[model samples]
Each structure stands twice: as C-alpha cells, then as structure tokens.
Target: MVRALVVGATRGLGASLTRQYASKASSTVFATTRSSVPKDFPENVKWLSGVDLQKPKVGDDLAGQLKGEKPLDLVIITAGRFTTEDFNDKGPNWDEEVTMYTTSSIAPVFLVHALFHAGLLSKGSKVVLVSSESGSITLRHESEGGGNYAHHASKAALNMVGRLLSLDLKDAGVVVSIIHPGFMRSDMTKGVGFDKFWDDGGAVTTDDAASSLVEWTEKLDISKTGEYWAPRGPGDIGTAEATLGKGLSTPLKLPWRWLLRKAISVILLRDTALVWSLLRFRTRTAIYDKTLFVKCGLPLAVPADQDAGDDAQADDPDGHATGDDETLAMG
Candidate 1:
C-alpha cells in the first residue's frame, strides 16, 4: 500500500490533501488532527489525535501509532498557526509570539527529528513541509510593509530547516521539500484578519491548493529535494508580478496583455511626439532664416538695400541701429 501521512490534517490544505490522497486507488492515507475529528473522515484513511506539533513528544506519539508498520511513503507536516503583531504595543506579548514560532517553525525540526529517529521515514520516502512564500525573503517587497514578525520569520526559519533536513536525509535517499501552497483561503488566514485580502490576493480554495500539492508531491524525488515550489504557480502570489516581472512567472498568460500593448503604444506615441517637435523646430529655423534675409535686406532683390541697411547701421554704431534691426526682425 502507498502509505501517506498528512500531518495536522484537520482543515484547509491538510484536510483537502487527505481527501485527495484517499481518492487514489491502492493508497492508505493517515492524517492527524489535534482533537476534533470531523465526522467526515475518508474511508480507509486513519486519523491520529493528540498530534500538536508544538510539543516535541508529539512526534514520538505519532511514531507509536504507526509503529511496526512499513516505512511511510510520504510524510507532510502542514500544522501551523499565524499571529498578527503590533509594532507599537508598548511591550511585546511573548506568549503569542512564541506560540507562532513554535507552531510554524520550531516544532517541525524536532517532529521530523523524532520521526527520522523512530524510523518512520524510510529510504526513498518523501518528506514535505508546507511552507509559505511569506517565508521567502526574496519575495518580500515594499508592498507588504509591516509586522507579523514571528509569522513571517518562522516560515523563513522553516525553509532553512527544510534545507538542512534535505542535506541530512540525502544519504538515506530521502527527499525533502519546502513549498508555498499558494495563497489559500482558510481559517488560518481568516483568523488573522487577512480575509479582506482574500479576493485581491488571488486566494484560492483549499481544494485547488491541495490538488496541485498532491500532484506535485506524487512526482517528487531527490532531484527536487530542499527546493521550494508553488504548485499553483504564480497566479495567486501578489508579489510575483512585482518581483519576477509581469507575465513571466504566472500560471496563465498575463491577465492584462493589453496593458503591455498599451505601454508599447505609449512609447510609440512618445517617439512620434519627439519627431513632430523636431520637425517644428527645423521649420521654425528655416522660416527664421528666410525672414531674416528679408528683414535685413539680404534677399537677392534687396542686396543693394542690404548695403544701405549696413551703412545705416554703421551710422548709428552706438545703439539706435541695433534697436532698429531688432524691431525689423520682430516685424
């Protein structure tokens, strides 16, 4: 049997992936929930309770459940919490801050350590840790200014854990991956009051996110170990366009192809404006040359008068003649 475990499989991506994995033939899926067992667990899928990742012993608890079993084919840790922070709270609230890191970042280190020591993950097993792009230091831009200090930093630390885990597990032929499951519409996001960003942030349903992740995980091997991926691609990632450049990283063709075309049109319009300005400048120069010849009596028909005008200018060498010349040019 292709045995797979979805850690923290209570709701959202974890729950959806549990259902997705069970849909496959010849697969027995195991999932974990903290306490509540939604009455709708999939048939043939086992649920493990008391698996809070914050506690290091939780891994040992999980190992006890799957003890004596074949090494797991896939292990995914998806249990995490996000906490909002205030920059000016007068003082930092250590409890919530610590809980955020413990839940999202620190626990995965020992949890995986426990499982590895317990022999729950065998050679060729795939270990997937659900990390977010929020963890991506590269993806951070000025658009998302602010605090969620632990929430963001924990994921970054988790990414580092994944990288280290990949190195440690490589000799055993185990593959590890850290991933951004796309912007998901879930309780974690909603609870943190980010629901207002749901639509604009390109947030997707957990089902869609799970489908992409399962498909990607199914094909994962050592070649992709320690790499981060967005199974849904860049469609829902708000920073992708700004950071990776428009259209280049998205799942579909750029939604506003016209915007690029409009940009080109503006450039062409600018060039045309420049050409028109240059033409007007040259035309004015030619007109001024013609007018000066006439006004200064330098035209072929007035060359004799030009000498008289020059003589007239010599007569008022002081200033009157120069003023007259200026008046003639203006006229």
Candidate 2:
C-alpha cells in the first residue's frame, strides 16, 4: 500500500492531490490543515488539523501526531504564502515577507527533518517541494520587471532546500523533487492580482495541476532527484519564449547552469578587487583566459569588456543575451 501525505491540504492543489490519492486503490492519504477539517471532507483521507507551518514547532507537532502511522511513500509540501510588492507604490511589507518565507521556505526544512528523524520517511520514498517558476532566476526577464521580492526569493530558497535534501537522502534511496506545478487559477493567485493574466498565461484549474503533479511523482526516482522541473511545461512561463526561445518541450528542466553563472557574475561584479586581479592575470595561459568563464557556465565575453560593445550571443540563433550579457540558449 502507498502512504502519501500532502501538507497544506485544506484547499487548492493540496486538496486536489488529497482527493486523488484517496480515490486510488491500495493507497492511504494523509492531509494537514491549519484550521478545523472542512465539512464533508473525504472519508478516506486522515486529516490532521491545526498544522500551521509558520509555527516553530510545526514539524515536531506533525511528527508526534503521526508517530504510529505507516511510513510515507510520498510527501508533498504544498504550503505557500504570497504578497505583491512594488517600489513605486506598495513596497515590501516586512510582516508579509516574514510570513511568506516562514511558510514557504523555512518550515519545509524542519518538517522534513522531523519526519526523517521520526522514521516516517524510509528508503524508496519521494519528497516533493512545490515551488514556482518565479523561483527560477534564469526564467526572469525584463517583461516581469522586479517586485514581490519575498515571494520570489522564498521559492528560490525552497528550491535550494530541495536540492540539499536530495543530496542528503541520496544514499538512503529517497528522492527529492522540486517542481513548478504550473500556473493555477486559485485563490492564492487571485488574491495576488494574477487573475488578470490567467487566460493569457494558460492557467489551469487546481485539479489539473494536481493531476499532473501526481503523475509526475509516479515517474520520479533517484535518477532525477534534485532537479527542478515544470511538469506543465513553459506554456505559462511568460518569459519562456523571450528568454528560452519557442517550441520548448514539456516537463522543462530549469537549468542550474544559469544559477552557477549568475552567482559567479555577481561575485565578480560586486568585488572590484577580484575583477582587477583577474584582469591582471589575463597574460596567463588559456586556462586563465575565457576558459574560466566557460567552465563556470558564464558567458565567454569578459566582464570588464561588457561595455566595449562586445554583445556576444549564444551560438543558437534563437537564443538571446540577458541584460547582464549572459547567453541563454535551448539545448
């Protein structure tokens, strides 16, 4: 029998996943909610109430509640909080940012750790962290502009947490998947004024997203653990065409190369002394030349020469250079 747990299962995708899992034969579904269990909740699903992710002891609370339960074959953390922000009018709200980070990023670490220590997660188990495409730095474009700092950064932090968890559990035969469950027409998005982009973004119902996630998790294993994926593809990613080009494939793997290159670029750009030292050592072998940039997954164009009209593009004609002159091309 498959024992699955869906955190934040009161509504939206989490609720849908709980229902679907409960319907499956030989499956036991467990769901968590911060409030009382809703009326007419699925009879088969075992609901655990008062499970707020923001609380510091949330993980311990959950582990204690499920102490005698069967080991979980799959665990999906779907809790999230979002708040809009803009520099011109609505600036970042400290309280909202704290709540968002705590719910989305911070809680997952504690929750998973407690579960592992409690022996709720065993070998061959799968852990899914429900992140967003907004977490992807490479997918960010000029079209989206800048705002919602905490909303975006929190998801990014969750992605990193997922990757680290995957590494830690690899030898234990546990798989950790970080995924963008696609744009969904949910209260969360509607409350954030994303409803305007629903039609244009190809946003689907929560049930649809949940279905895809369940199917995707079925195929997940140790081989693809630690990877970030968009199970519903780039159709809803506004910058997909502008940043990654057209005719993109489904279940897109958000690249880690861009993250690597951006990190290196940020270091070089912020530290003038480091940049100067690298420039001074330009007379060294080819390894010290543009090779270092290439190895770090950075653009071949030297950072010092960015303003020299050196707009080097990727070899692919469909590709484009980012504002920082980073080359992004579809493989």
Candidate 3:
C-alpha cells in the first residue's frame, strides 16, 4: 500500500488530514507530533514522537519507522506556530524566535534533503509545505499591524525554502509545493471572528480544507511543481505562471490546458452575454413596436393583439370616439 508522512499531525488541518488519509487513502500514515496524540485518532495512524523537524535525525527516525513498511509515498510538512506578540515573548532573544521560524521555514527543506540523502523519495514522491500568505513578499504592501515578526519572517523563509527544494527535487521526480490554509477556526486562532470569517468565505473547517488541499495536490501535474496554492481556491497567486515555472526549478512552462480553458471560458461568457443582450433588445423592441402601433390606432398585428384591443373595446366600446369603419379597421 502507499505510505505518507504528515508532520505536525496532532490537531487542526494535520489532524483532519490524518483522519482523511486513514479513511480515504489506502496508506499507512505516520503522524508526527512533539508530544502526545489524542486517543480517538484512527487505528492505522502511527503517532511518532519527538519530531523536532528543525533539528537533525527527524528524517532518520522517519526512515527507520518506514523501513519494513511499504515504500514511502508522500511527505507533507504542516508543522507551524503563530505568535501574535513579539518573537521572544516567553524566553530571551533569537533562540525561541529563530527556532519557531526555522522550524517552519528552514527545517522542511533540510528534511527533504535528508529524505533524498537517505533515498526515501527516490522517485515519484511528493512533498507539500503548509505555508501562509503572511510570508509572501508580494503581500507586504497590504499588511497591517505587522507585529508577528517571527511568524511572518519564518513563513517567508519557508516560501523561499520550498521554492528552492522544488527546484532541487524536480529531477528526483519529487513535486514540491506550498499551500496557504487561510484563517481556519482552530486552536491556533481561538476567539477570532468565526462568524465573519465564514461569512467572507475565508475561514474553512479543517476537514473541508484538508480534503480540498489533498485533492488539489493529487491533481498536480509535473508542470505544477513549485507552485503556490491557496486552499481557499485558485486566482489568488501573485504570479502563478512565473512562480510555477521557477519554484519547481525546471524550465519555465505554462499549463497550456489551463490557458486554453481560461480563454475558452472568456469567449463563451462574452458570447452568452451578447446573446442575452440581443434577445433582451429584441424583446424590448417588439414591446415598443406593439405599444406604438396600438397608440397610433393601427390594426392589431397578431391574434393576441386583436384580442387585447377587442377586450379593451368591450370594456368601453363607445367610450372611444367611433371613427369611420375603414379608419378604425386600419387602426
């Protein structure tokens, strides 16, 4: 059976993915955690301990766990933390701050490197980095309040690392990609506006988000390596084409099917609008023509038209001045 490793799989999206893969995919899942896992987790899931991904030996421990099992299939790095306060709120300078960001940004790349070094992701394997738009340099112009320095920086660093790894792993047949999970209603963002979030279609349930993300990842072509994805759906990428090309570190190429579909959709929409406009215009013209003819005292043109005139006349046949029979017939 296929095998997959999900780093940071204790809660939220990771936990949901654990459930999803266990229920849906026929694979032995290794869910990584720093401490304990809930008792209610699925039976097929193996909760591995001490997954300090930022440090060494993480890949080794993972490799050892899967040594006698089925071939390694996929690796998803979803381990992350968010601190709204300063970098060193609880502890002293840079160590805590550095570790937090490094785990998110730097460590995953090294983990992939370690995996390849150990021949785990030899070929036909995939790696996904659960990143955030908060790390995007393109979004810096739009950021407000900017206090989560370590979190933001770490994510940005993670973006860079994911891109580089995508390039490095391209020839190895390992597809590397990054995904933004949006503002999910999880322990990570407790007491945040849940109602407004769903109203705006931004906050997604962990199950919904995981299912969609896995579907997107599974649908990725060899051409989509190194692309940035928003779990909220498509069209939010800053430079999708450019990023897709470089991030995978392969020759720059576009998904021609995507371009073709977009062009066709645009054409079909234009045609549909034009057809509707023409039909509406014709309907309005017909209505105006009939109204004007009736007001000008011209003979009714259709059976329904004649009936309307006859009905009006029956209501007040003599109310309207009876003109000559020939003129009234012509009208």
Best candidate according to lDDT: 2
Clashes (N, CA, C under 3 Å) per candidate: 0, 0, 3
Which one wins by TM-score: 1 or 2?
A: 2
Give, for candidate 1, the lowest lDDT window spanning 10 residues: 250-259
On TM-score, who's better, 2 or 3? 2
- Which residue pairs collide, candidate 3? 297-331, 298-331, 299-331
Descending-TM-score candidate ranking: 2, 1, 3
TM-score of 3: 0.64
**Cα lDDT tens digits for candidate 1, 170-244:** 999899988888888999899988899999888999999998888788888888787777777887777777755
lDDT order of candidates, top first = 2, 1, 3
TM-score of each: 0.73, 0.80, 0.64
Worst 10 residues of 3 by lDDT: 249-258
Q: Write the per-residue lDDT of candidate 3 for residues 258-301, one digit (tens) a residue.
A: 33333334554567666455445544553322332343333433
For each candidate, what is the lDDT? 0.74, 0.84, 0.64
For candidate 1, report its TM-score.
Answer: 0.73
Over the full model, what C-alpha lDDT does candidate 2 score relative to the true structure?
A: 0.84
Candidate 2 backbone clash number: 0
The count of backbone overlaps in candidate 1 is 0
